[model samples]
Target: MTETITRTTGSADVRGLSRWTAAVILPIGPAAVALLRYFLPYDTVDDSSTMTSKVMAEPGRMSLVLWLGFIALLTLVPAAYSVGRMTRRRAPLLTAIAMFLVVPGYLALPWLAGTDQLLWSGTEAGLDANTITRLAETPHPTVAVAGVFFVLGHVLGTILLGMAMWRSKVVARWAAVAVIVSQPIHFVAAVIIPNHTLDLIGWGLQAVGFAVVGWAILRLRNDDWDLPAVA
Candidate 1:
């Protein structure tokens, strides 16, 4: 019986630690991305050569931006996982589906970031911008597929996770709504309108939403944050 109680206590401790870790990390990725957008403000509609030129013009700033982007990508999966954990009890299926979508989507980001490095290297080598652009834009079918997955996964997955959070009632309705609407705004700002200010605002909303959620999690007792272990 003593061993059994010890096992139960250990389980509870692990669960509590997991919840705390998740809450602490949830806002990091989006906040980093928002900062990146604010600092870099790269024009998405520019051709590869133009974009490369812009990066070359400010190599120091570009390096910072790249690091920020890397941080955002690194933390995204954990942020998504936190959302899944928050909603799982009340909206298991939705959380499951969102995780399925976001894991692959977030994982694909590093692959896409390779373009930035390639462009920077090409410029440093004094390669023709047009030639570098052509090489970068080479129609690799695998990359094309990953791009599709990345787009659909992040946008759709985030929306679904927000819905799950709403259904769970773990966070305020406004916070959940903020999370839900953020991605659509990001999509429009980054793709359709290509406004850096709007992109910053969009990612800012996500950061705000996750910040609130993290606060709520912090306020919960360990037992409330996760199921108590039964001896």
Candidate 2:
């Protein structure tokens, strides 16, 4: 009886975790991402010199970017995991692929971007302009590879996950649409807007997608909590 109770408790914990991840962490990540983008210094990507200058000009403001990014990164792991759990039964293969891609991709960019910026913010006084320029301009191959994965994860993974959710019929159809449409919408907003004015909109839409997904997960009436059987 004790053994059976322990097994049941473990299963309940897993279900609870999935629900918490989907409902809370997932939505929080996108909102944090939006806040990070909105607070970033202007034209940090313009050039090496411009990037260095901006970092030095406002270290305090730049520091906020790193903090926000850290929060986003923290939430992304569970968000991705919840996506996997939600889709595993209906679309196992695709969901597996999405998790494989998104886990690393989503984690890498934020950590790398945050580290890259923090280096400048933390030690502007000790570092020289030439050093800063070199650090800023030098291309790290690892970062390039990570960027590819990150793009694939967000673009492809999100779309696949959205499709899986739709096909599963566990969530409202419009929720799937929100998750699917957010990426391209963000891309278009980035292209059309100046000074990243639409960044809030883009990120806001992503948060909405997660929020809708969270709600859908909460509404799941399955005895299994819609979780796939783990071997």
Using TM-score as the measure, which candidate wins?
Answer: 1
Report model 1's TM-score to 2 decimal places. 0.87
lDDT tens per residue, model 2, 1-231: 353222233343456566655688778887887777777765434566766767777778778878888788888778868767777888888788778777887877753584457455545556866677776667667877777887788777777777777787667787777777766666555444534546766677668777877777787754557444342
The regions of model 2 sitting more than 4 angstroms off are 1-14, 43-45, 126-128, 189-195, 226-231
Residue 128 lDDT (model 2): 69
The alpha-carbon deviation from the true structure for residue 68 of candidate 1, after best TM-score superposition, in angstroms, is: 0.6
Taking all chains together, each candidate's TM-score versus the true structure is 0.87, 0.79
Q: For candidate 2, what is the total of clashing residue pairs?
A: 0
Deviation (Å) of 204 in candidate 1: 1.1
Angstrom error of the Cα, residue 60, model 2: value is 2.0
Candidates in order: C-alpha RMSD to true structure: 3.2, 4.3
Q: Which candidate gets the maximum lDDT versus the true structure?
A: 1
Give the range of the ten consecutive residues with the poorest summed lDDT in model 2.
3-12
The lDDT values for all models are: 0.81, 0.70
